[model samples]
Target: MANQTEVLRLLMANAPEYCSGDRLADELNISRTAIWKMVQGLQTAGYSIESRHGRGYRYVENNQLSVAGIQNGLDITPAVQLIVLPSVDSTNAYLKRMATRTPLTEPVVVVADSQTAGYGRSGRTFYSPGETGIYLSIGLPVTTDQPLDAGLLTTSTAVVVAQTLRQLFDVPVELKWVNDVLVNHHKVVGIMSEGITNLETGQISTVVVGIGINLTTAAFPSPLQSKAGAVLAHPTKVTRNQVIRQLLRTFFERYPSYRSGDFMPLYRQLSMVINQRVSLKSGARTYDGVVLDIAQTGALVVQLTDGRVQEFSSGEITKVNLLTGQYHG
Candidate 1:
């Protein structure tokens, strides 16, 4: 009998047209009963299978979180299961609930078509339009011989996401220090990583990494009309599925090294803020300095004109002229 993947492939190949049960069964050389079971399974797995009494079954159009599309694009076998949700409050929150029941690994990916409550760094609300963007979260379980600081992981994710966007979309993507992806001087993506360690055991159990990318949309909220944007806000339109696939492949390719605590090399090579001048803003205090480099421990190293170098962890900083598309001080 043809499995779910094969059945889905047939439906996708014959989209806008219905595939009869008998035809599907004959193609896969299986009984109609097996085909019926597969259809049921697909529906339960979040694939919108539309059935007509005489027209047979057809794939629904605009199913944003298509498991079949994502499965076909993945090159590496997933270590953790990929759960595709049609609509959710947030992928991070959903996966956190699953982590309590299931032991999630590095490759586990959770994707949603839309989020009801998505936010950027510092609790700024993220505008996620249904079927208009990529909203994903990953769970990374860790236990280090030495304690791993939280800020390092956030910076690493920020840099990787910025590079991934640039390479995939062929755009001038920039990193806003902690966890924002800017394209053409506007915010297009946001990443957040939260570490969870057992208090009594002191063992780092899991790090929930959330990534939100704006794609396909053409405009931002009314208030953000002057500052934020989607990829379509640039010169081209990128599919949400493509963004998710590229990000997953890039992450998996680099994750092994990160797991071994050797990600500094990749971090150094992908650093976008180094050698650029940025403004650190916190309340009334603001410091403008030239970025020297990012330390192995994930500190932003900066050198003032007076020759004083300082390292900032996270928060308390923002790239000067980030929205201007200029890296100059």
Candidate 2:
């Protein structure tokens, strides 16, 4: 571990209470001057640390997201490490490269304050403005006899994210088809799952699930302003670290059920378009249908206009009209 990381761990272990400079220096085997420098660096990086001449230093609970803060919040054994970045092209892209170069354990998470090239389903650009949203990707190792469809991972993540947000904010969150979480009919979260497959066995070796959330964004780019929204109109008691920790913890807890298809019931219940009329766009063809149900394998079972019921595993929902029961791409 780096000296700075160790210093943060010590401070977090004794948060809201002063950790004397002498004690910190002695424990970290560094000079008190070094401790002061580390504290200054942390403060510069957006951590709120309080210093008293005689009392030493204390980490104030300001509810901001930091590597140390997230580490402190997690209570699970075999701790999940966090890699926080100021800016990145995409968390998923970074972690994918890391996974190839290094062996990753389960539940490794990468978080970015902003992503310049964040993408969604069908390679659509995901808007990730700096300091206003959560752009995270979690890599999980899976070994199974059956091939894991990437869509299942996307749907399961959507369920976990929606459930976590609803529980945390006491708000209504709904899932739109395969990978979107909506609130008040506007998108708040976009999830995309990418996997590394074993060519010989055709099984997914690792799954990287990336999610972009609009937490407190005031305004979006003109292209997304009409349909994109944040979780809150303004900042609330919720902190970015809180959301990250809760999301990871909840996802791990629910992942087993999700894998076993037990989450299908709640997924169906939380869906925003189960019974609504929607336009399903698969490649060049578009079909208007009413959503009847969602299959356990994560396929959308739609009743088409010509009175034929069909299941689509992958498609873009171009448009959905609730009042007039009309849909079009």
Candidate 3:
């Protein structure tokens, strides 16, 4: 009998059209009864596989995440590696452990369907649940002795994600200060970047950037019910596999020149905090200010209430009057 992933691949290749039972059996070198059993199994696994007595099977395309499916759609190089897991503690943690054992000169992309212990900046647990999200992490190894800018890595990845979502879904995607992607005025994606230091060399070798997106997630915990949102609320856009493919393709295509500040123009255009009334909380103090601009160096330029203009490369955004969203008060 044909496996689930292969069945999905062939069905997706002939999406919206029925592939005859004889054809499926012939390609997989199985019997018609085997194909029928496989189709039934797929239908039970939350996939929409429609079949008729005379006609064959049609895929409605709300697919579960599979490495085979994702890799089949990627336009990536031979050096890039891809991995997909059903459940993991965290994609970033998994890659960090792998980086210690594996030689990583090229790119390695690891994605989990859900994370039981996912985390973002400041060590906050990202609410990752199954059947509705994509948690991805990429390992970028240091090819040369050049140092990497942690800030640019995060900000640049944020711009790449926002750009990909806009191009694919045609939605009003925006970026919050630092590392958050907003959709429909709510946070739909959370990004975190970490530099992995080699224990032997005492130098940072690999940079792990994790991206978590709420894709068709309809419910969240009570505390996050209002703050979390989904990229595609309905099955209107493309599949999750396609989303991952596009994000990977776009990010790598610009990786060579991202640090050159060429992405700043698009970053500035997608910013949600620029020129907005904002409140910055640095340590125990909270100061109110209005954002001026996103500097080329990735620093946040703010004009505070005391009339002292300041530029902050790092701070806590306790509150901000987002034009797309209402104030906390």
Candidate 4:
């Protein structure tokens, strides 16, 4: 039988039109029985395929994720390669391990259908159920000349993701300071950035930005039920590949601005915490303050109730209360 990727490509290329069993078998160099089995596999994998008695198979218009469809949608340069995995432990971990073994030539983007050991900021387990979310990581080389601020990278990523989601779905997407994207005040996206630095010069050599988005997830773990959310409220016609392609396009387009610290302005505009009463947790200590602004370097500037203004470069913003005067996580 033809592999799932190849089968998908053939169906997508001739979408809305049935490709006869004889044609599929001849083109794939397989038997008609093999074609039937492959169609069953595609249906099992969430593709909506309709098989008629005489018309053969037709690829229905549905929200199924397709690697070929996504690759066709992307206008990325040939130097950048996109790899889609049926399953993986984690895209970030996979790319990080690959970086250690081989010298990465060009930018490599690894996207998985699901992650078994997906993680987020501070080692939190990012809920990554299969076939419902986008798990992607980009491995790119960065030198001292184009220095990247690790703090700004995650925030800038959130900005671009929020912008893309808003433009695509025409929904209200907001950025929760530092690494989370929220819609309707519920988190829908989480981002993490890991890099290797030169010990001598204290500059980063390579950086991998990992992003996980809950696209059409219907449920979450009990612990995250109240905090987590998917971007789409209803099952629309958006496919996973479309989301992946648009995200990559937006990220690369805005990446130069992120390197130049120009994304801070848009980050401030999409911020959910700014001007809101917030509770920040740093280690065992907690501070209650109102977020005044986000610094150019991506730090959260806050003014405490006791009339002291402080800048927090790293901390967990446990809670943000837009309506209430007091905030608690």
Q: Candidate 1: how large is its RMSD? A: 5.0
Q: Name the candidate that leads on TM-score.
A: 2
lDDT per residue (tens digit) for residues 70-144 in model 2: 767677644566799989999999988887676465668899988989998768899998878999998877666
Off by over 4 Å in 3: 1-11, 14-60, 232-237, 282-287, 322-329
Write down the lDDT that model 4 would get.
0.83
TM-score quality measure for candidate 3: 0.85
**Candidate 2 C-alpha RMSD relative to the actual structure:** 2.8
Estimate the TM-score of every prediction.
0.76, 0.90, 0.85, 0.83
Candidate 3, after superposition: displacement of residue 270 in Å? 1.6
CA lDDT scores, all candidates in order: 0.72, 0.82, 0.84, 0.83
- Residue pairs clashing in model 2 are none
Candidate 2 displacement at residue 63 in angstroms = 6.0
Clashing pairs in 3: none
Q: What digit string (tens of lDDT, one per residue) describes model 1 on residues 223-252?
A: 877667776544344456656777787776
Encode model 3's per-residue lDDT on 41-98: one tens digit a residue.
Answer: 8888777889877889988766577775677657766368889888999999999999
The per-candidate count of clashes, in order, stands at: 0, 0, 0, 0
- Give Cα distance to truth, residue 259, candidate 2, Å: 1.9
